[model samples]
Target: MNKQAQAVVMLLFGGAIVRASLTDMYLRYVKESLRPFLIAAGLVLIAAAVMTLVHEVLRPKERAEEHDHGHDHGDGKPHREPWVAWLLILPVLGLLLVAPPALGSYAAGQSGTALSSQQISDYPPLPPGDPAKISVLDYASRAVFDKGVSLGDRTVRLTGFIASGPNGEPILARIILSCCAADGRPIKLGMSGNAPAGLANDSWVEVIGRYTDRTITDPVNEETIPYIEVETWTQIDPPKQQYE
Candidate 1:
């Protein structure tokens, strides 16, 4: 691409980034904490594009002189870019039109629950609520690492998309991201007891259950997969942000 076309591509790319960040579409790809940086990057790209276009217009004589001399580019009529240069717009169009959906059960199934490799300390007990709401990561750690002692007798509320267990049993899962979806992995709790029947994979649900001693080895990752004795569950719309 010529300088002008490159500038236009930068402008479009920057606009897509800014729009996605402002509208929460960026949450699909990155953590919420990176919003300011994303916006700033978009602004810088926009600024740089504007500067390049302005310089190109204000210094037409320089461009003409280079074209006449052919510079070092043999027989160049203002040195055209390769056809591949236009491919950069594909990502811009994808982001501007529709950001991809958040990772779901498919991602969870491909990689089993992510657990810490180091030995863990005893965890504090669940809070005072009858069905205390807790994050999937917290509950997974307490269940698998602390061995459910911290969850003893506590009815807990957990929310995540349904994933298929090895034997076709449904499991509750949340995709955990340290920074962005690129680094995401699943943390899962197998459903047992009164787990609602016929809950399909990828269905979003909120489950009420108590931790069970039951666990199975994850076939994919060969990690200890923990279980929850579900007392009740309800299907719900997918959350705005799917990762923990």
Candidate 2:
């Protein structure tokens, strides 16, 4: 596309990045250090726009001989370029400036709201009172499907936000998904022991604890509550995105 169109697209994306960063949504979905890339890209687009403007103003008028080829479209007609060509810069600028945040309660109750219920027989058992090293997706998947069976009786640590559930008690929660937030599934964690005082919904926390299999009968279905008997609860910043 023409430089002017490209510049406009870049500006649009730059605005989006600014909005996302200011709202902390970028941190939720993207790494913090990458924000500068957006600003740089936007500046480049602005520069390109200035260059295009200068070139249009400074170019000498074409002589009549330039049209000797008998072209139906004369040079006097303004050049037109597709707008889509300029759109390419948007994603790059958006990522560099402010990546989108992880899905939160806004997507908690949609269809495909839980992880696959496959038997996790291969997962190694956790040793009591040890810090568990697992991906966020694996943790969420285990919580959703395996629940009691997956956790069994073991001490582990998990980090995520306190998401709202149907009931009033704030359930320790995390998201698991096959793709983006639109496909995210919510996994509720059972919190035990002394939870940190003044824990609010959406507050980020790390819980080091053990698991107990408790059967919870939901109105929709019978599910197991894989309870985490909290050994210690520490507040922390939430990740930018729910899924890696």
Candidate 3:
């Protein structure tokens, strides 16, 4: 690849980043807090490409003079980049053509729910509502550490995708992201009672349930994840934001 091709590839890559961020598609890969940084990075890439092209076009005479004077570092060869560097544009092309969906049940089933003391105390008080809406992370923390004190005797609603447990039981699960999909981890709650009709892996669903005393211990590591006594469930389309 030459300088011009490299610049063009940068421009395309930058444009794709900016577009994804602006359109909220970046949520699939990164947290909302990273929107500004992603946009800034895209703009910097675009500016660098534009400046490089401008300099080349505006200083044609200087380049010609350098060439005539054999200013090629006296190596008898002009600058050249390795051909493999052109592969950088493959990501941009894939993003443009496919626009892959966010991580799903397959990833959730592969990992155990991670718990920490600091995270257990970080959640806000349970909000006011009939079926108090709460995140999977918050639920996991309270259920494991506090023993569902805040959630006692109250119906709670959780929205997430269905993941198959090791024994093929349907579990309500969501990916918790600190920064991006690369670092995302799954937190899950086991559902009791009948699963909603047509329940399948990766299917988004809203579960109305209460925390149960039953705790599920992972067979591999013995980490305890809580269970919920489900009252009812409704299948729904995947939300615009897929991560917690």
Candidate 4:
């Protein structure tokens, strides 16, 4: 590609990235903490593209001279690396034409939780709240590895989607994202009783339950997953924040 074409493509890609971040479309792939970084990256890319365009426009004769020099001394063979530049179009098109959806139940079921030794330390006390709203990772750590010592008879509520499980069973599942959807892992909690009848896959539900069993084993890792004795549940609209 020529310098002008390259600069235009860069500008389009940079604008697309900025637009996605501004519109919250970036949340579909990454955590909210990355918003500022993404915006900055997009702006930097845009600035680089604008500078390249300006330099190319103002010094067209110099660019032409350099191009001639590059070929004139050589065998007049074209550079093979320019074709690789086309690969950029794939992500650009993906963002512009068909923005991908967030990883859902299918991906959750496919992945398993792996707790690093560093992450298995003593958890602090739960924050103040009725029922003490807790995260799936916290519940899993306390219930599985800590043997439920921290969760003493406290009524806790968890919010996640229904994942695929054995027939007549309800599995409460959450996706734990480190950086983005590509690095997300699934943390699952099994329910003792059946879910509300006919609850579809990816159905967002708020489960009001307490830790039931500490011996629950994860099907994926053969380690432990959180088990909750269902006190009650209610179907709700998908939350604005989808990942933990």
Q: In lDDT terms, how accurate is model 4?
A: 0.77
For each candidate, what is the lDDT? Answer: 0.85, 0.57, 0.81, 0.77
Q: Report clashes for each candidate as comma-separated counts.
A: 0, 9, 0, 0
Model 2: runs farther than 4 Å from truth?
1-6, 11-101, 109-112, 118-121, 125-129, 135-152, 177-179, 193-197, 215-225, 240-244
Model 1, C-alpha of 240: deviation from truth (Å): 1.7
Angstrom error at residue 129, model 4: 3.4
Number of the top TM-score candidate = 1
The sequence of per-residue lDDT tens digits that candidate 4 reaches over residues 1-244 is: 6676688888888898899999868888899999999999999989999999898878858656654444443767544335677787777777878887677788866766554334665877777876889987788788876667788778788898988753336688888888998898888877765344468878999877777773455566665566887788999988877899
Order candidates by lDDT, high to low. Answer: 1, 3, 4, 2
Between 1 and 4, whose TM-score is larger? 1
Candidate 3, superposed: residue stretches over 4 Å from native: 61-80, 117-125
Q: Candidate 1's residue-wise lDDT over 1-244, tens digit each?
A: 6677789999999998999889868888988889999999999999999998998888858665653443456554445456797998888888888668899888988996797647575787687879999998888888888888788888999999988887888888999888999999998888889886786788999999998888888888788888889998899998888788
**Location of the lowest summed lDDT over 10 successive residues in candidate 4:** 64-73
Which candidate wins on lDDT? 1
**Model 2, CA-based lDDT:** 0.57
Worst 10 residues of 2 by lDDT: 63-72
